[model samples]
Target: MNQHLRRLAFACTLFYTAAFASASQEKAKAPDAPAATRSRTLVIEPFMRVTNSSPTVVELQIALRKFTAPGGKGPAVWLSAVSHIGETNYYGALQKHLDAQALVLFEGVQARASTNAPAPEAARGAPTKEPAATQPAAPAKAAAPPDKSAKQTSIQHTLAESLGLVFQLEAIDYKRATFRNSDLSIQELQKIMEGDPDDPADASPAKKNEQLDRLVKVMDGSSFVGKMFAGVIQIIGTSPRLQGLTRLALIETLGQIRGDITQMNGLPPDMQTLMKVLIVERNRAVMKDLKSELEKAEPAKSISIFYGAGHMEDFERRLRRELKLEPGETLWLPAFSVDLQKAGLSKFETEMIRGMVKKQMEVILP
Candidate 1:
């Protein structure tokens, strides 16, 4: 299989477990430094001023964890133990980090229902004068267009909704904006998969699976190898010994996205290039827009760049090296947790399961 496809498959498997469980910041002050040195402070740093009044700007990086509380709402973790931040505290701090007057930027396109009305006339507020009764009846309003925003959804939006939390940046009172609007929509990505000449999109679903099967067999030198690995995980997960364990302890259960995700460095060069297009380039656009906003924002106002966790490392590098912003003190929010102790499993059983899970993770993660 193509390395990208293999990685894709691993991700898909995790999603399946998610459905089963689906119902289931710090700061420091610094003394004034030289102009060039001051330029190196983080956006949140007091010394980092977009204007003389000194508006604080910061970025909040997030990963998806359950939005509901830990009682059977969906997949979750023990707040403090795993990722070190709890769900409630995570959202609470996020709200606190976002100041009232700051502009909030999100990673999505601004969408609204399509309409035929003239832009100027609608934006002008009440018409200056009522049109004469004789004026030709405005062409019967084309069946009022459907609400476009209603239909449009992004991963970020969906995840937030699932958690029953909303970003202040997304609030009507806030000046919400998107750093880049030219991202590939879901339909566009689907088209790419369908249009690839080697693997035409028009194939029947069964045929596509057959093709994928053949590809995997060739790539791994045995069609059964992938199934065997999955079977091992399934056995480890469902064994009676593990019955008392929480869903989080299941070897293949989803929502275990913890630890450093730096393994992208091990991917083939071509795969790396693909990821750069998917992630890094989008961030460059974000930084470009951010620079413009910083220059224009009112002094003493704050700004928040809320984006995925994966983007932060690269963004911080760009901030310090390119934008002359230095890293400030760190804050950790509990995003996901799996309370093995709560599952009532014995220490010996937990260790055995952890060993199996770790072995499987090692095999697939890199």
Candidate 2:
């Protein structure tokens, strides 16, 4: 296998899984003040990413409609981070709680299939066109065609259906946002690796070839480590006893994302550069799109941006410093539950595990 291609694949696997992963702080309650005096909520939460095989955990989220603006009844906005894969029950629940006219905006949305494309002739053809003999003696009734309008259901669309809300289809296209493509290009990367004293960014074919060879060697060595780490993270995130501790670990790991490439032990500098490009630059781009959406939104509307927990710190700071939006409430939703009954742990053992989690959190935070 080409080392460069293998490295790209490995990095993408890790990025897809970790992209939606987030950490949560202890849950907090909304104020008990009257609706007339209540401030609109800007929810900040961490979420654990899930797949079909993983145990379903609580999805930490903020529904802006929950914080109604006083004397201002209208739709709220939900800005989300995850890409649209398929339909799920979670979006259904969210739709039930939002305003009828609310809007849900998602980040990194793909360019939609063209609406103007010619409709299929088969769709318009009569079902009973064939002759009686040509069709079987007792022709089976053809099944109803699937609804094309509802085919591409992202979290936004699913929620929109129940909420009677509209979606502002303005997210960046998925092609431009992938792990390898979103970051610095290979040629640019080669220039950085081959720094010059007079012209630090000077590029040459020899230097490019040299850098490519080095990258190939480095990727071959690190592929196993990357895969192993990704598997370990997923396991810890789903296990009953270690899930909480895993949150703390993820927070610590993502927190150091801004550090220099030299600090990334074991991984090649090129790989480290790609990781930074994937996490940092991509997040900033998401934030920029979100800011644009917010500006276009109507004033006094309650709006929420549902993103990964690691992003909350930077986003919150930006909102406060640049946009003047302050968080009014924050909460935690458990991604999954530990069933002691299923695990068959003694009460003493359960207490011991809880104590250990608390201790680990204390050490990891502050």
Candidate 3:
């Protein structure tokens, strides 16, 4: 009887162990769930490219709106960086239409998915004991990037490609340089531009010297501070303390001023001062704008706003941190594809695109 009891206990232990191992295997195969579930959201769609060539942005926005509607969400918002670049007067046009939880921007750099991975293991109660030996298995690896034939085909993608080339050039050239407080004078700035102080500054995002003149004219009657700020932004996008920004944000801001300044020719100093405070003052205004939106609860009519991907952190992690949006709810619209037949590319152009995306579709499974 004693021998039989011992046999029964051993068999039960084996059965339990097998069950636990099977469950663990199943968990490993499941997909990584999304970061945001179906939390109500309003997305403001913006297309940064110029007009008349291709309406890819508007088309994609419409497609996304249609796709999300069946899920019973609100209308998507509309605003374009190209169109809103200049505010000839006070910032008013879109103000009336703006209201939401937050205008989350994207810098397009969210590769790290684990914040906890870097935390202290002891704090997480990591195991320290030597356990029984088991059959060795290969270590799991990262999922392969989406496949190449599956290259992003949307207009945003084409813009992203063209803009990526531009961003890389700017980074190589204008990475932050130290400037002494004594060097913050108009004469020095002019010299920097004239001297071509940065070797191979061909990649600098600044426009021609004429562009700076136009900005000065726009702030004609404004305070000297305004003129200084505008000049500073042109020379350096942000203070060194706030470095590591996507150049797109600064380029877009400067683009608006460069475009609007031409209209401000002969304006009084005060008018120019207003533009100064409006255009060049980045951090505070942005934080305030973001805070206001995040505080505003999602109404029945809310949508998503796509700004610089950098702004996404302030919205997702900083502002709406409490909401803890589940992964499935935060929708990343799949970039659209172009029909090869309709693209009308020369054989060379087609080959170039294919080569660029050869890595796009190839999934390197480990």
Candidate with better lDDT, 2 vs 3: 2
Best of the candidates, TM-score: 1
Please provide, for model 1 over 219-247, each residue's C-alpha lDDT reduced to its tens digit, 9 standing for 90 to 100.
22244644443333343233332322323
Ten residues in a row with the worst lDDT in model 3? 174-183
Q: TM-score of every model?
A: 0.42, 0.39, 0.23
lDDT value for model 1: 0.33
* Candidate 3 C-alpha lDDT tens digits along 144-242: 211222123221222223222211111111111110000012222333445443324442424434444453332221335434433433322222211
RMSD of each: 15.7, 16.0, 29.5
Query: What local lDDT does model 3 show for residue 253?
Result: 23
The C-alpha stretches of model 2 lying farther than 4 A from their native spots are 1-91, 95-102, 107-277, 297-303, 329-334, 355-366
How does model 3 fare in lDDT?
A: 0.25
Give the runs in model 1 whose Cα sits over 4 Å from its true position: 1-89, 99-101, 109-273, 297-300, 360-366
Candidate 2's displacement at residue 337, Å, is 1.2
